[model samples]
Structure formats: structure tokens, C-alpha cells
Target: MTIERIRVLGLGKVGELVAHLLGGAGFEVAGGDLRPRPDLGFPVDVFDVGDPESLRSELDGFDAVVSCLPYDRNLGVAEAAAVAGLHYFDLTEDVPTTTRIRELAVGSDVVMAPQCGLAPGLVGIVGSSLADGLTDLRRMQLRVGALPQHPSGVLGYAFTWSPEGVINEYINDCEVIRDGHRQLVPAMADIETVVISGDRLEAFATSGGLGTLCETYDGRIRHLDYKTLRYPGHCDAIRFLLDELALRDRRELAGEILVNAKPPVDDDVVYLYAAVEGQGPDGLTRREYVRAWQPIEIAGRMWRAISWTTAASACGVVELVARGAVPGKGFLRQEDVSFDDLLSTPTGSLFRDEVAVA
Candidate 1:
């Protein structure tokens, strides 16, 4: 259960930060990418991520492997980790990918946890904690948004994270518990207005943000759902691109076009909101946790809010596994993660600190 050495796959924005945070927390960390990244302050291994044999060979000596690769590249990395008998973690929001990883975890000696990032990871943890305090859980609503502090153009968005991932979430079918029944609904179908910190925003159904909470809370909570928040009118613009323009049929091209139009922004804000309504000791009650996080200084360097928040959530879960605070074998569920334990870790404390709202 003592994880000393970790091998991080991919050296992108979130991946690099994850390695840095784990190293700062006293883990011997190294990185692997298609290109050389010697400037990451750790050893870097250049290898073909698509080749399964190379991936398994690279993961041999590490106690665990964290895959920050794109959602499509994670299954191979996860398979390699399983073969090496290493605990595995990933930031994938793809439902089919997580389902396959769950199959890999069965009867395995190491843990296989996926979806350990912002919406599916942190928001799931927060929502579950709030639900635990209630008697008759009626509804659980979770929302998260990563956007530029200032915006222009019709979209009013930036690609602070992966453009491919965003496009996948936008067009995929969402799973939710509606009217006490588990069902799949089209993404962007249910739109609602949400206000946070005097800012008016819109939220709509998104795929994979709920993680495993739909199954975990099925038949217990009357209504359970998750959504991605955006500035008003943003959803309409995206729908026009995917539906009216027929870009949903060509997701790769859509991603390329969107990223070209709205590149990643340095000054970004991450908004998180979770509310649980049920029966309390007094009567019907509602409990909510809301926070607005901005870019932060860590390890003497500034990190984008989206990057740090996602990295912190992944690293915090890894830290918990290292300390035996959670299960070390089989599949790990984000809803099962204790929010208090996450806040106690060095990486998770980054979320504990607040920043001025933009």
C-alpha cells in the first residue's frame, strides 16, 4: 500500500502538474510522452504510447501509473498497468473507457480507478458527502465549469482543457436517474439557469460527469443528475455547431475547429456547485457547497485553474491510496472517496484554499 514511485503518462498541462504535485508530496515521480520533456524537473521517457509492450515495460518498477492521456489512449495504459500489477489512475470521462477498465480490475491485485478529475471526480465526492448528511435523499445536483474570466465572441469559452474531451461530452448521451428510473438522455437537452457569486450562467446535461453516482444512488435518491455550466448563450452556440452545422458527425474536425477558435486561456476560473436536498431532522432541507477557484501559485510557478484543480483531484486520490485511506485493490469509485480525507492530503489542500472571484 506504500506507493513511493509513480509513473505519469503524458506530459500535457494537467499531466505535468500532476507529476509536479506528486513529487512535491514526496513521491518519486517520472513522466513519459511521445516527445522529450526534460524540463519537467523529472526524468522523462520518450516512447510510443500506442504500443502495449513498450507501455508495460515502462511501468515495471513504479508502484502506480497515472494516465493523463486523452480519453481514447487510456485503455492501453490501463491494460499495461494491470499487467505490471501496479495501481492505476486516470482522468478519463468516457463512459465506455471506464467500463472496460472496470473489467480489467476484476480479480486484479491492484486498484484501477478512472474519472479522477474535476466534474466526475471532485464534484462526485462533494455531492456524496452532502447526501450522507440527509435522511430521505430527494435530489442531488452537481455542476462544474471552466471558463475564461473575461470573454468575447459568441461562444464565451476557452479550451482550458482538452478540446476533444469537450466535444465528446457535448454530443454523447448522458446517464441520469429521472423519475426514480435510470435512463439515458441526450446531452444538452435539459437546460437550466444557474447563478453563482452574482454571475448568471446556464447548465445542461452532459455525458460522464455523474461518474458512477447514478448507480450508487439509484432507487434511493429521487432525482440525481450532473451538468456542465457555461455563460449564458454558450450552450446555444455549441448546439448550433454540433446540430445545425452537422459537426457532431465529425468530432475530430469539430475539436480542431473549436480549439483553433478558442485556445486555452491562462487566466481561467473553475466554478463548482453541488446541492443535495432531502429530509433533515427539521424538515425538507437543502445543503450546498459552492466555490470559485482561479489560477494559483504552486511550487513557485503559476498554474491554470483548470489544470491545477484537475491535477489536485487526481493526485489527492493517489495520495489516499498510498496512505491506505481507501481500498487498494479492485475498482475505485469517486463517490466512495471521502471528501475530508481528500482535503487532508497535501495535493487536496490546494482545493481547500479560496481565491478572489473574477
Candidate 2:
């Protein structure tokens, strides 16, 4: 069989990384973005994401469309992909948008996979894979953080990804399964401290990180939650701003504040830690733990850990779908991915070796 051809939408840092990884894997790669991006290292076909007809025209003749754009724009892209009968994938962590995409996927001829990035993407896969091995699953906790390698700020965090997306996760409603019941909890409300790899970190409920897992494991598990990890004191500061200052009601203002205050950097680290505890076949309790510490590198260019992991994971799933590894129709969740299949893919192998060492 011939290699699949893909067209990646959005030419941001993550989009560029997707194009490079797919191109290296012997796929004919093309890119499309709203604005002209000359630094993408290859020709970027200009197409406005806001224009649905134009997007449909650009996406023609491609096996799949990988969207690295923000969450708000993903619905349109998914619609375009479905209409064109091309597989659709994105790195969104927004709840409502993902819900819409799921609705769009019903009875469609092409696959629609959203939330294919770090927390909602690989973390969900790893956690669910662990859950699959247990005889009687009890609890599952997933924590992921993309932190600056070197910190010098009040928040001790950098804008490694989308500032708006970060704000959405911080302030939006989170879906969690508590006491074997699916519940919606406010983000930044259930703050807790955790120690990983000898470094103290903070974690709290974050929106869109669970990616349909609460419903997937609703009655089977006593607890299932996903949190975003940050350095010590980061949650408190955000809580004060979002809760005390009433910034949660004003998400646009909150996003602007984060954009203006936090600095974007190329030197960052992505941390993933997931733990699942349940009963074993021997009538003994067992636990499965997966941890990954991936640092940033971009061949010769500068790319942060968040950028590399988030972008690569999305592109990796797209590659898998194009190569006929994933089902071609209906709604797809991150947890549906197989661990072995993921490790064999070119871009997905980046996390595979890292997790092996951890």
C-alpha cells in the first residue's frame, strides 16, 4: 500500500512540528493556516480557518486533516473533514467543543478524534490501558504538567501552549467520576499537592482533561479524575485571581492577563504521571504507574516540551488513522488507542521510550 497524504491545518509551533514529523515518516505533507507563515520550513498553503467553504476546498484530496488550531476553531474543521470524508483530529481540551464534535461524528463516514494532545490525549490512553489490565479497578488518577525548565516569575509557569486554552481549563467546569458517580466540578476548586520525581508539585481539577473517560468508567471505578500539575504556589495564585478577583466570569480578560504576564519559552519540560489501583487475578491488590519526563528539543530549532508532546501526539494519531490503524468512522476517544500501536508510530515513539525509562 502507498503512504497516506496529510494536510495539517494551522502553522503555529505545534503545526510546524506536526508537518515535520509526518513528512519524515514518508507521508506527503502539506500545511494550511489563516495567515502567511514563512518560517514553517516548507510551503504553507494559506487558508482561512474561519471560512468553511475555503477550508473544504483546501482539505480536498487529503487522507486526513490534523488541526493544531485552538479549540474554538476545531468544530468547523471537524465539520469540513466530515463533509469531505477525511479523518479529523485535533488538540482541543474544551468540553463543549468536543461534545459538538462527538455529535458530528454520529453516522459519519470519517473519524472525528478530538482532545488528542497531552493531558486529554496520551494521559487518557495510558490511564485507560492500565485500567484494562486490572481485574477489578478501584481508582485512577492522572496528572500532567508542562512546566518551564527554569522559572523566574511569580506564577513559575510559562505560556508553552495556548493562553486562552489554559484559562479555559483553569476556570471551566471539569467532568469527574467521584464515588462511582459522574459529577461536574469547578476547575481549581479541588487543589492538592503531589510529589513527583522528588519535586513537589500542585494539581487540581481541570476541564477537558478527562476526555469522555468519566462516562467511559462511570460505574466501574470508585474514583476517576484528571488534574493539571504545576509548581508549588501556582494553584493558589490562580485561585486568587480566578476566584477571589472574579476573573473566571471574564475569561477574555483572564486570557489577556495571562498572555501579557506570562512569557512563552522554548525551554520547558512536560511531565506525565498516572496511577491506577485495582484487584489482580491472584486476589491481591495491584497498581500500575506510568511517568514520563520529556524535555524540549527541535532538531536545531527551539521547541518547548509542551509544544513537542502536544503537537506530536496529535500528528501521531493522524498518522495512525491514515495508515489504517484506527477505525475510519464514528466518534473516537483517546483511550481507544492501543499502547503497542502508539509506541510503534514514528512520532508516538518519542513518549514511548521516555515512559520506559520513567
**Per-candidate TM-score against the hidden true structure:** 0.98, 0.94
What is the TM-score (0 to 1) of candidate 1? 0.98
Per-residue accuracy of model 2 over 216-312 as CA lDDT, tens digit each: 8977898899999998889888888888999878988988887778878767877787888887776646455646455645577666677778877
Candidate 2 lDDT for residue 341: 80
Question: Which residue pairs clash within candidate 2?
Answer: none
Candidate 1 local distance difference test against the native: 0.92
Which stretches of candidate 1 lie above 4 Å from their native place?
A: 355-358
Residue 23's lDDT within candidate 2 is: 88
Q: Can you write out model 1's per-residue Cα lDDT over 21-118, one digit (the tens) per residue?
A: 99999999999999998677999999988997788788888999999998999999898888888999999999999999999999988889999999
Give the Å shift of residue 68 in candidate 2.
Answer: 0.7
Task: Report the error of model 1 at residue 248, Å.
Answer: 0.9
For each predicted model, how many residue pairs clash, with residues at least 3 apart or on different chains? 0, 0
